[model samples]
Each structure stands twice: as C-alpha cells, then as structure tokens.
Target: MDERKLPSPCVVVLVGPGAAGKSTWAGERFAGELVVSSDRLRALVGAGEDDLAASADAFDLLEAVVRQRIGRRLTTVIDTLGLDRERRLRWLALAREHGMPCVAVAFDTPAAECRRRNRERVKRIPADALAAQLTTWNRVKKELPGEGFDEVLQAATEVRVVPEAFVQADAAVRREDAAPRGLRFGLQVSSYTHKGGRKTTGEWIRQVGARAEAAGFDAIYVMDHFRQIPQVGRAWEDFLESWTTLAYLAACTERVRLGTLVTGITYRNVAHLGKIVATLDVLSGGRAVCGVGLGWFEAEHKAYGWEFPSTAERYALLEDALQVLPVLWGAGNKGFSGKVLEVPDTTCYPRPLQDNVPLLVGGSGPRTLRLAARYADAANVFGDVTRVREKAEYLKAQPRQIELTHLSTTLIGRDQREVDALVNQLRPRNQDPARYAATANAGTITDQVGRFRALAEAGAAEVMFSLPNLDDDLSPLDTAGEVISAFR
Candidate 1:
C-alpha cells in the first residue's frame, strides 16, 4: 500500500461486513478518542460488547456521540459493521449538514477471509447472521458511490488526512510572483499570563528573546495594549506595556530585533512615539523596528480613558503621522502641516541609531496600504494563502512598491493529534474546532512551513505571527526553527 492522506476535521465512515478488518484499520490510523465505536458503547451499557440485548441503548449513545463530534467539526471515524444503509445515510447527512467531507472507506476482504476471522473470534456472530452480512456488504459497496459521499476510498496499508490547506498550499508553492528575496520569520509574544506569574515575567521575557534569537527568528514582536484584548485573553489578564518591556528586553538579547506587532497610532502623540522607539533602537544597538497601525479595539480605548475617534478620523490622523514621522526621525528638525495634524517643532534628541529605521505599517485596508506604500518600508497583512496572494497583487499595483509581510495568531503542533489538543485549549465557547483553527491559524510545524512558504511565494518578505503558548512554554521555539530553516 502507498501513503495517502485525507483532509483533517472531516468525517470518515468505515464500510465492511463482519470481521472485514474495519476496526483494525481504523484503530491503526486514528487516535482512540476520535473513533466512535458502537461495540465500545455496548460494553459500557450492556453485559459486553457482543451482548445483543443492549444493541438499542448502545446505538442510541453512539448516535448522540457522533452528532456531538460532528457539531464540533472534529475528525470522527464511525466504527461499526457498515451494512445498514439507513445508518450510513444518517452519518452522511450529519457530515453534510456541518460542511465536512464524508469519506466512505470500503474494506474489501474475501468472504473466505471474513468467515475465517469471524470463527476465530471469542464471540462470533451466528453463522446465519455472518452470511446475511456478507450479502448486505455487496449491496452496500454498490450503493456507496451513489450515497453522496465526498469520496469513496479503499483502505489498505497507509492512509492519512491531507488537512484542509493542501490545494491552496500547492497553488501557493507554484505561484509565479512569489517573492524572490527570500523569507524571514518573526515571533510575536502576545500574552504573559503563564503559570509563572508577574514575578517571573522579567525572566520569561529574557528566555523568550533568547530562545527566539537562537532558533533563527529574525525578530521578536510584542502587542501594544492597556489590557489583554478579547481575542488573546480576557480583559483582566496580565498584560505588559509594549515599549517599556522591549526596552528592558533589549539588554537581555543580542542580534534579534525587538518591536511591537503594532503600536496604535492613537495611543500616543506621534512625536512621543518617535522618541520612545528611537531610545529603544539606541538601547538595543540599532536592533529596533517600529510597527504602527490605525488602532482598533475601541473597548480598550474606552477602558484606558483614551478617546476612540471615528474610523475616518483615525485614518486621517494616521496619514498625518506617516507624513511627519520621517521628519521627526531624520537629521534636520522639521515641522509638519497635514490633513489632520500639525507639529510646531519636531525637535527630538538621540535620533534612531539605524541609518534607516524599518517602518512597518500593519493593516490591509485600502487607505492603510496606501499610507504604507508611500511612507513605510513594509506592509503587514493576513489571510489564507489565496487571500494573501490577492493582497500581494493589490500591493504591487501601488506606484511605490514596499515589502509584503503577514501577521497571524498561530497555534502550532508537531502533528495532527497535537494540533487537535492545542485547538482544544483555546477553542472558543461553543465554536467548532475547524472554525477556531481558521481564526488562530492552527496547524503543525510542518503545516505552518507549507503555509508560510506559500506566503513567501506570494511576495511576502516576512511572516510575523503570535503564538498562543508563549505564556509558559519556550519549547515551541526549537520546533518552530524548522520553518526558519526552510526559508534560509
């Protein structure tokens, strides 16, 4: 048998008569929790798995479990003697209702093999019953292709899930306009609510910077927020101010640049932001990047007693700031008069140490992209591979070309099982795993490599993503290095 893969977060129905190796095949390929077996349910409810008297209750429990798993958008394998058309139809309907692909894995064992295996079982079905199942299986096999299954598969030696990103990933890898300038990966630390508490934050930040730098990360970015945002955590969780912490961290690590994933344009006066980032650059020996954006999170603004301006007002302010920031950082003292702001005197001492401070504009909106193209060295955006490619095209259309980058909240694992577990930890209240995976950009390290490679192919020069487990773990740094290595 050759190696084959199926999509994750999908439904798989095993089709076979008694003792046709369906159970063994499913057991070999899937984790125990993902396989919903009627026999196991019977063992709990009845005298034993083979007890005929408990069939109705066992089936009832089985249906309930299957419905729940499908509702959650989890990969589920229905393990049963797959001869009942009615039951198969129910499973297919459930899979379709949830927009998951339903796959029928046909176990085509010879009748002689089935009877031989059945006779050797400790509790075999009646000889007459076995014969009846053999007859029913032939009919089931013929009807499966017509039953609206997304796929009909023959199970043999090797089978695995391809995950949902395969087609897009393949296309991204083949894109003609992929950035030819190589790629860089940056780690953005969003939360400090690890088990270590506030006392250990200083130590944790040092560990995080050191690990990322050692693992070949190009930069370590942090979020700027007064309180933990609702997307990353609750409002009250421990949150650190971005630049003050970055200033302290600048001393702890060498080589890797430190910057904010984005500093809100409304948080501070533009000149004040220039001074802070300049100091950080000077302190870190020129390893500093300044990422600014049109600030969202209106609730955070209200909580912090800052005025949350309307969207149009903010964009105007952002454009004004972009026009004057270079004058603030440049050699001469200059003042700015723009659409929304004017500075009387732009006199700041201790200019950024870098000859060219990397200015990043973080947003994909039309106006933001326009601002980035005119003033920023790079523009950051996010989406699946296809959307990312489209965004790269949009950026290319601008007269002044700037580097393309991506920003995402990442939850990475070693493989499918670990991916599932990580999703379970952060999966939202009543939201399906599939939906959350999209929100968090969840996948294995290998999955991420493929995704990022596609991003690189889409003309993105760098991928900046926040990790969910930065709270307590630095181990992901080592595994994440594999991605960095691919681009290098």
Candidate 2:
C-alpha cells in the first residue's frame, strides 16, 4: 500500500501497539514539526524508556506540550499507542475545538512481529504486555474512523531497525530543542548620574545610547520623571525629562528604539504628547514607541506642580488620552475635546516618519488592559513570573492581539560574591533590593539566562530591564547583549 500524505497544519496521532515503529514513522514524516512522544518524554524524565513509574508524568507533560503547540497553530504529531480509547477521545475533541483536522494511523503489524522487535530493543516490553497491547490495538483500530479521526491509515510492517538513522533522529531532536523562541529585550537607563558619581552630563547619556545600540538592545527606555523616585535615591537626585532624553538619545544612536518606560498621560496635554512622539519618531528615524499610562507618582506630580487627581479621575483622563493621541498622529487637522483636555482643529505638522507611532500602554489593571486592547499596540506588565503569567493570559483572552511586554529591574554581576556586594550596597536604599531577591531576575550571568527563559515561557513578548550599574561600566550591557543574542 502507498504511504499517505497527511494534511498540513493538522494533528497526526499515531495509533499502534508498542514496538510497532511509531517513533520511526513520526520522525520520518514530521521531523521539523513538534512531536509529542510518550516513550521519548519518559526517557527524558525517568531512568529510561522502560520506566513504567514515569508514565503518568510523561503523558501529563505530553498533553500540556501538545496543547501549547496546538494553541500556536503548529502542526504536531503524537507518537503513542492509542489503545486507551478515553485518552484518544480527549485529544480528538481538543483538535475539533481548535478547528484543526486530526488523522490517525494504526500500525497493524502482527503481535509476534511486535514482540520480536521489542526483544531486540534495550527497553524490552514483557511478552504478556505486548499481547495485551495488540489485543487493545485491534479493538481501537476498528473504532478509530467513527471515533472522530478525519482520516485513517493502516501500516502492515514494523519499522526497520537502523542505528545510524536513529542517531540522525537524535540530532534532529537536539536542533529542535535548540530553536529560539521569540522574545525581544530592551535596556532602561534608570539613573542619570555620571560615571564618577558627580553629575549628569550629555557625554554620559550619549555614551549610554551608543553602547546600548552597539550592544544590540531592541530599545532604550527612560523613567518619565523630572526627579528620581524615592526608591532609586533621594527625590532631589538627578533625573532628566523623558521626551528630552529620548530626543537626545535619538541623535546619539542609529539602530536601537527609544521611548519612556511609560509617559504619564497627565504631565502634558495629550495632543502635545502626540506631537512630541511624532517629532521623536522623525528624529530617531522611526524608532520611537510612545509608552503611556495613567500618572502613578503623586509625589512627583506634587514636586513638579502638576495637579494630582483622584485614582478614578486619572483613569478616566487616561482613557480620553488614548482616544485623542492616535487621531492627532493621523492625517489632517483634527479637533478633540474631552473633560480634561482639548485640541481645537489644529494640524499636527511634520508628521512622524513612521506611518503610526507605536503606542505601548503600561499598567496591569483590568481597565488599563481593556484600554490597551482598544487602542495601544502593546502593554507593559511588571512583577514576578506568576503575575506576569496571569496578566499575559488575561490580556491574551482580550479582543485584540496587543503585544505583552514585561518591565523589570535586573541586577547582575560576574559572580555570586559580586552579586552579594551589589545587593548589599542597594539594600539600605529601599526594601526593593531584598524584595527583588525573591522575584526579580538577579545574580550571575548563568542565573540571568535561566530567569529570562522562565519569562519567555510565561508569555512576555518583549522585556525592558534596568541595570543598576549601567552607568559605572558598559561591560554589563555588552554581557547582556551576548546573553540576549545567545538566548535568541
């Protein structure tokens, strides 16, 4: 019989007795696609493929991976004996729910042949278990077509044993394991103080922009404040205006994107903020991302003489800004009047080089996420992996496909001793250093990579991390670049 050509973008579930060559068939047909195999996973998590005790955990992991792959719309193959009718029905129903077609291939090799194949393997199945599997397979094959497979095929031979081909399969599996999952990284320069700890200088800021660009950061972000937050240092400590710093950095760097971690909506009129981002987009050669949110720091607002509104009023104001900012960025003279602000038929001249200045909404509130889904190109979330995961899931379920970015403070050093020293130096400034110790991705280079992997797994599409010692030496930026590159 001729082999079948399975449909693209479908789940192919291989059904057969043990030692019937399901692994070899799957490897040949779906080498590049994700294959969730029970025996392979069992070997990975347990003593070997023969570890019956590991079966429960292996299949659980297999189900989770298959679901994830299906959610991603990737073609996947599950190489497992489908003698368990209940288990196969669950997978069939899942594919149906996702609108993906499912196919079943039943290996019809004789019980004696399967037993022969099993005897030649290191992880041999017992003769009685092999007979039971074959008995179950016969019943499963009869019911497969009616039980919800879109198509079914029958194979008459056990897989040919080839050691060299198995070696190649192992290598292919390794390459699949090594493929980079998508996640982008950016740098946020939290402090403006100079290298000698004396004063903020243009030279220092310019150096930062250049180094970050050269180090391969996707973007460089700054705090949208006129004075340092108390957690970073004294309120009087040096801080630069957000838009001005972005404009300066635009002139200093060529490739990296630039933006405020988030610009407070109430600091300036919404139309004026749009104009600023449009100009920065032109100046940066279309690298500006307008990250905005409801103003949170009452102290900073009081110090800058800006009116601080109640939390409810501030959210309402932000909702209005989200409505007005995009219109001002678009073509023609636009007029928008809101309770808190207004633009009276004014033309936004010298429009941004980019067609649309990408707006990133920053906040984790339900209302904020709803606003982001309605208006912004992305949303920024902050906190531990668990919070990040929860927010990511919630936002993903929202109506739009807004990008989710994680904002974090990353502390790094060459060794544990160096890391402890940095932590000790910053611990007195605020409880944050110790708090970060529990949740923030901090420590040596090796530790940071592991932490980043967890963030990616948690569904953060992009990340912006502030290095505490970015001003002291540029080496950490270089190291971070290396790590990001390697991870990608």
Q: Write the per-residue lDDT of candidate 2 for residues 1-488, one digit (tens) a residue.
A: 44343333568788999999888877764443367889888998898888999999999988998888777655678888878888788888888888877878888888878888998988688888888898888888788889868877666422211111121232323342487666788998888775555454787888888888887788999988888887677887777888998999999999988999888987887878888988899888999999999888998788778899998888888888887887887888869887776778647778888887888999998889888988888889997667889988987898778888988778776655676567666565654343444333456565566556666777888889988767657777887876576555
In TM-score terms, candidate 1 sits at 0.88
Global local distance difference test of model 2: 0.77
Best by lDDT: 1
Lowest lDDT sum, 10 consecutive residues, model 1, at 172-181
For candidate 2, what is the TM-score?
A: 0.62
Q: What is the TM-score of each candidate against the true structure?
A: 0.88, 0.62
RMSD of 1: 3.4
* Per-residue accuracy of model 1 over 65-91 as CA lDDT, tens digit each: 999999978889999987889999999
List lDDT for all candidates, in order. 0.84, 0.77
Error of 2 at 196 (Å): 3.1
